[model samples]
Target: MSTTYEFQAETKRMLQLMINSIYTNREIFLRELISNASDAIDKLRFAALTETNLVPEDANYEIFLVPDQKNKALTISDNGIGMTQEELIANIGTIAKSGTKEFIDKLQNHEHLNATELIGQFGVGFYSAFMVADKITLLTKKAGTDLAFKWESTGDGKYNIEPASKESCGTTITLHLKEEHTLDSNNEQNYLNQQTLQTLVKKYSDYIRFPIKMLFDIPVQESDSVETKQELKILNSMAPLWTKNKNDIKPDEYNQLYKHLFLDWQDPLDVIHTRAEGVFEYITLLYIPEHAPYDFYQKEHTTGIKLYSKNVFIMDDCRELLPEYLRFVKGIIDTPDVSLNISREILQQNQTLKKIGKNLEKTILKNLEVMLKNSRDKYLKFFKEFGKAIKHGIYADYSSHEKLRELLLFPSSRSVTEDSLITLAEYVANMKPEQDVIYYATGKDRQAIDSLPQIEVLKEKGLEILYFLDRVDEFAIDMLAEYAGKKFQSISRGQLDLSKFETEQDKASQDKLINENKDLLEAIKNALTEKVDEVRISNRLKSSPVCLISSDSGISISMEQILADVQDSKIKATKILELNPNHEIFKTLKRTFEVDAQSEQFVDYCKLLYGQATLLEGLTVENPVDFAKLIAKLMK
Candidate 1:
């Protein structure tokens, strides 16, 4: 007797969506189906670990695909856990109970779910067959069950289940291919005939735990009879690299594995193998590449971490395995606790996956920290390649900012060595007692920051400031406000309070000199109106006559210029000009201003000071050629 079943109203809607809208790429249907077969095989394998009788000694646990051109049908069969009649209806005919209600609600509300993520999470493998087939027939007999059954569906939300006679302990899915699709004449008769499908299987499902074979039809010579057609076969390697123990893997093997996994040519700079046992059990094999991918920063770039459950490949490009900040990292994560039916959306919300992800991040940061401490030269090489990515991590998530700060490196002002980059930890270790904050100044280069009159004063005080030259340096420091209990203070921002180094009398003396040059400062500030926030006698400048500074809230002149070069906006924030009381120009300015605060020479002198400061800070003046002429006039 045939039994008729009406899909739940929600199931009907979800099925329609899956058929028409869920799958943008029809080829994924093959992947989905193959993944399901692999999962079925995995179930039997796991069960065999404890229940030997349940596993057939000669079962040969394999997935086989057979395509018939004459019949226009594709058959994918698996020697694994086949379902009973009731189980078939529950597992295949209906959606899983947990998500059926929500899936229906989403369909009713016209909400869309990513089909790849949905099928991966919901264990809806059978529905994927509809992508390439007008009809699907599933024939199966449960292990240890005598009664076999056939379930037939036209993929229009209706299916029929009836008794069948089969002497096998597995399931066979037959997809009657659409009229337009046919196997080529030159192709082999079996699964080997479809080279493209084999390549896709390798690309997406290579790591499946069970053996996948493609059956091909080829003419065979017989000794006594005429040539006859025989089945030819090929096996897809289902064991992935991450599932193996660290000791069993070689460096070259890992490289080959990563290339296959990510489809990229570059070798990785480092690989991290982590096996966590306490509270959670999982294995993670992560690779840090020597160079970033072409689309590393793009939204469309696939994050390379695959998710697996008990060595069975569940999903590739699983973002839940790592945060977007670590998107450059390529690897695999195998967890036994993760559900086989885990979907992408559910994965984002999975607490266990979140914990695994957190642990993975921790492990990577720890690995980097170790590399920096043990292999300074190697770490520097890594920093040269991935420093920007690390800086990106600092701005990516607040939770990881502190860890990223510890990983950042910069050039020190007092360090004479050009190649050495010091980390915040190193800087903090070398910091002088009574230096309450870590000082940093961002600019185009070290020489520019060194020549700035403001840095001259800091050098005079014998305080070391970090020279940030990379474009990402400023943004990183902005995100990482403090490290090791010391706040990061920008040296070129506002006025410096040197009370820790200079006595009160020295401060008072400097204040007196500033008061005396008030008129000259006012003339300079007025000449550079809106450009200079303020002009004052500089206690910091030791040799240079003047230097530029920004308001406490604004980025430094050098930083502003660097940003302007890359940023689309041509307009930049203004800067303040600070003059040295000890310099000869300030002495001349005082006398020149006393004669006539608005004299043409004094005005020219003010513009010259502002222009010189701008140049020293690595910025172009309104007229570079005019500034050169002004300098020539001044020299003459």
Candidate 2:
């Protein structure tokens, strides 16, 4: 008797989407079919562990492809665990039993979905066949069972199944090619041709445990003429690189593997090969790309690690294995102990896998620390490509903050070149004996940070400062808070104590200048009441006439610029205008102020000086047009 069934409503929708919509490339159908065949073979091998009578002990298991171009059909056969009639009805006739309904719901909800991982994790890869074929026929016989079953479908939401007989305990799936999806489309016959099938197998399933075989015709020379003979040839090596011992694998082999796996044309900057034998048994091979990809900074942060269990391909984008900041790292991780029977949602919280993630993160970081100390040039090249990502780790992963901090490098106020990157340790080693705080400043360009009056004073005292031009710089520093017990202080902030660096005579001179200009300070303070929080006598300035400084609790100019484009910032800016009190411009200005405490000329000088201070801090003058007129009037 034959039984026909209607697919669940959701399953019907999924079938249509798979057949004519969701999948962008029809070529992936071959890969899906190959993966399913490998999975069945794996299940059979596992089952044979306890039930030897299920199949002969010496039985050979492999995948074979028979192409019938004249009939427009291609059959994929696997000698592995086949399904019973009841299993066929439950697995193929419904969506709920197949774990695909939930995934479809999530896709429809428009969540931040990783389509590749979802499809790989759900165990519903069988549906991909609809993308290439309008009709599909399946023949199977469960091992050690007398009955066989045949299932047929046109993928129009209905399928029929009946009991049948087969020669072996395995499964064979045949696809009736659609005209547009066939090898005959666009004047090309390679799509369903033997050569094209072999190429697809090699590209996607070359590392499956079972050999993939195809029928090949070769020319043999017996005399002066050549004759063609049919031969069965293995198309896949079925060797996974991570499964091999590191000592036996050569560097060229690794390069080739990386090229094939990553689809990257250039060789990796470096590779880290690791294996574990104790508490956790696993092997991982990691690669650092030679350069950053164009989408490295995308918020989703593409996961590059391929996770496997007992050599069964689980997921290539299981991001929980590695933190988001390490998204640039490309690698494969295989473990024999990880359980693949549970749902993907629970698999992520698996205690054993979490333990592996922590250990792997530590291992990768230690490897980087070694490269940094040993290979200066190569390390810089790596840093040039992924420095910001490393720094981002500080903010994203607190557990690895200390390690990530050591790997950070920044352009220094002491370095001769703008591109030179220095570490905090380097800054400490070269710091002045009299300096107690680590000084840093941020700006849009090298010239702007260097021109800050605050930086100039530190430069005169032979103090080193770190330049943080990258937007992430401040957040990284905030995460670290301090390095080796020294606090990171912005030089543009108010009340940076330079008194410790000055001698008794220098202190006395600054004190005398402030005391003499006390009256002039009051005049300027009254003229610019709303422009600045407070008018103060400068203690750090030497040659420059004046400069602006943020309050000890206020936002620095650099941090302000970072958030300047934001519509609203919880932190407000409060700046202090500090006069040099010793520069020649100030000396003349003091004399003019003393002569007429309320003169219009004194008020203009206060406003003009404020404009100059704002410009020096890499900020814009509030009234550029009026400020420019003030300067012109002063010139006359």
Name the top lDDT candidate.
Answer: 2
Which model scores highest in TM-score? 2
Query: Residue 362 deviation, candidate 1, in Å?
Result: 1.7
The residue-by-residue lDDT of candidate 2 on 432-471, one tens digit each, is 7767778888887788787788677888778888998888
Whole-model alpha-carbon lDDT for candidate 2: 0.79
lDDT of each: 0.75, 0.79
Q: Write down the TM-score of every candidate.
A: 0.63, 0.70
Off by over 4 Å in 2: 1-212, 220-226, 396-398, 566-570
Model 1 lDDT, full chain set: 0.75
Task: Tell me the RMSD of model 2 versus the true structure.
Answer: 9.1
Give candidate 1 misplaced runs (Cα > 4 Å): 1-237, 277-281, 298-300, 503-508, 562-574, 624-636
Clashing pairs counted in every model: 8, 0
